[model samples]
Target: MHVLVTGAARGIGAAVVAACRAKQHRVTACDIDASALAGVYAEREGVDCVALDVADAGSWDSVLAEVWARQPVDALINVAGVLRAGVTGELDPADVALQLNVNVRGVIYGTDAAARLMRGRGSGHIVNIGSTSCLFAVPGNGVYSASKHAVRGFTIAAAGDLRSHGLNVSLVCPGAVKTDMLEQQRGDDRAALTFEGKRALDASEVADVIVDHVLVKKPLETYLPGGDQWKGKLCTVLPEVFLSSVEKSREKGIRNFKSPQH
Candidate 1:
């Protein structure tokens, strides 16, 4: 299958690109960080990289055109995103806008572009990367949660809108992945994930599952390592209890949101 993955420089996106290439599927990777993309898999068989800033609509169009010029895209994975942590009082308008623009608007643009191509082909899958934050709003990371919630909402609506035309949509929710992003958070004064909590996830593992599902069921959403399974089930069945547990966990350092020294 011909696949295009945004934010493919490293972390989940890079892992997914490698996995797809291992499967012998043609893969195109786009990211704003050209250096990071260059550091990743070289121009190997079935793998290509391009500079892409998902927040820019024109970049999306240019990359899509470039990919189509090579081969028809079968899957478009919207994996590029940004996150920030702040309560209402501490929230920086600029940070909030960055999150909203990149995390929310970026997905909207990608969704629209992917839907157009997928609908025309009458066969394709569009996967949007969501987060567990979409379920429970963290205290300091409300903006991050809001952006991810937007993703969750958009995925559901897009699923309905595209289903009649043979297009598939899935939201991939990953919990506490170990990545450069996580590393950056470690030093930030308002981080939501700590080293201990970060141990639970490996980006490559999540990427493997993504490749598996997109090739198989192409379901509405797939959570990495079954995070959505238990998380969603508990949140739905016992919201108050789950939320209370989260609060208790935070208090007990089960999930640390405090910053670590560099």
Candidate 2:
């Protein structure tokens, strides 16, 4: 399968590129950081690199055109995202907009481009990388969580729109993966709610499943390590009980692990 991955410079995106290449799929690795991608995959087999800012719709259009000129794209994994961990009043307006633009606008633009390029073509997939925060509102990351929540909403609606026509759209919600992004959150006291009781997820473990599902079979939604999907659903139906459970977990994690010195 031919695959296009955004946010391919590092972490989960880079891991997905490696997994796809391991499977011998023709892969286009894209990121806002072109130099970082070149440093990692310049000599790698079955991989081509492209620079992209996923927040820009035009960037998606231009790149998709270039990619289609060579061969039809079989899958697009929207992994480019940003996060800011702060108390609600402490966040800057710009930070909030960046999160919404990258997390929500990027996915919508990518989905539209995929539809334009691959719609009704009998086989194509759009997989979005979302967060477990999509399931519940974490204290330090209000707008970031809202942005992920928007991605989840868009995925379900887009899947319903495209699934009958042989195109698939899905969202993968992951717990905190050990990455630079997670590192940024560690300094924020409010984010203890997030780090509470959760082990860092491996990027490859998350990436490999993405490759498997997008190419082999497609589900409307998937949560890494299993059961997160149910957890998100329960949050809606049982809001108070759900929140109490999260608070309990946070307290337990605090008791067991001391916060690292900054």
Candidate 3:
């Protein structure tokens, strides 16, 4: 399978590229940072790197043309994302818009373009990387949470729309993972996040879940560590009470994070 993965320079995207390579799948990894992409792959075959920003339409079209020229893309994974810390009172609208542009609009563009190609050939899979934050109301990161929720909504709708046309769609919602994104968020309130100061899951774990689900042809939505899947469901079913409690917990947690920023 010829697979195209974005934001593949580090973290879960990198891990996913590695996993697909191990499975003997042809992978094209793209990222805006050339050094980040270069540092990871010493000598990788069946994998080529492209420096492309997902938020730019012209850049995406150019990259997609390059990808198509090399090989027909059998699968496209939209893993590019940004994490921001902000609340309604202290957040910049531009930051929030940037988050949506990268996290939501990026997925939309990739999915739409890939789906059009796959529909003509009658085969393809599109996997979107979302966060467990979509499941609940994260206190200071309300904007980030909302962006992910949009991803989830789009993934579900894409699944329904693409099924009849012989296309596959799945949303990979991973919990906390060890990555630079979280490190950059040190000062921000992490109280609203699941598992305080505890290592949740690694990028490799998330990659495994994503690859396994894709191979098995699972449903449009797949939540990693299905055991905690109920929490997201509960959050959806009881948004008012659940979100109120989460906000309270986040306020309490931020208090501990004031001086040290941990």
lDDT per residue for candidate 1 within 91-140, as digits (tens), equals 89999999999999899999898788778869888999987776756566
Query: How do all the candidates rank in terms of TM-score, highest first?
Result: 2, 3, 1
Per-residue lDDT of model 2, residues 1-262, tens digit only: 8999999999899999989988899999999898999999878888999998899999999999999999888989999999987677688988889999999999999998888778757779889999887887776678888999899988989988887778888888888787778777664566766677447687888898888764577777788757777877788678787767766776654553454421
Worst 10 residues of 2 by lDDT: 253-262
Candidate 3 backbone collisions, by pair: none
TM-score, one value per model = 0.89, 0.93, 0.90
Q: Clashes in model 1: which pairs?
A: none
lDDT of 3 by residue, 1-262 (tens): 8889999999889999988998898999999897888787757888899888888877888888888888989889899999888867878888888999999989988888778778988888899999887786677778888899999999999999999999989888877676777666655664345444234577888888777666567567777667446877887888887766765566555454442323
Off by over 4 Å in 2: 245-247, 253-262
Candidate 3 residue 227 Cα shift, in angstroms, is 3.2
The Cα error of candidate 2 at residue 79, in Å, is 0.7
Question: Clash number for model 3?
Answer: 0
| Candidate 2's TM-score | 0.93
Number of the top lDDT candidate: 2
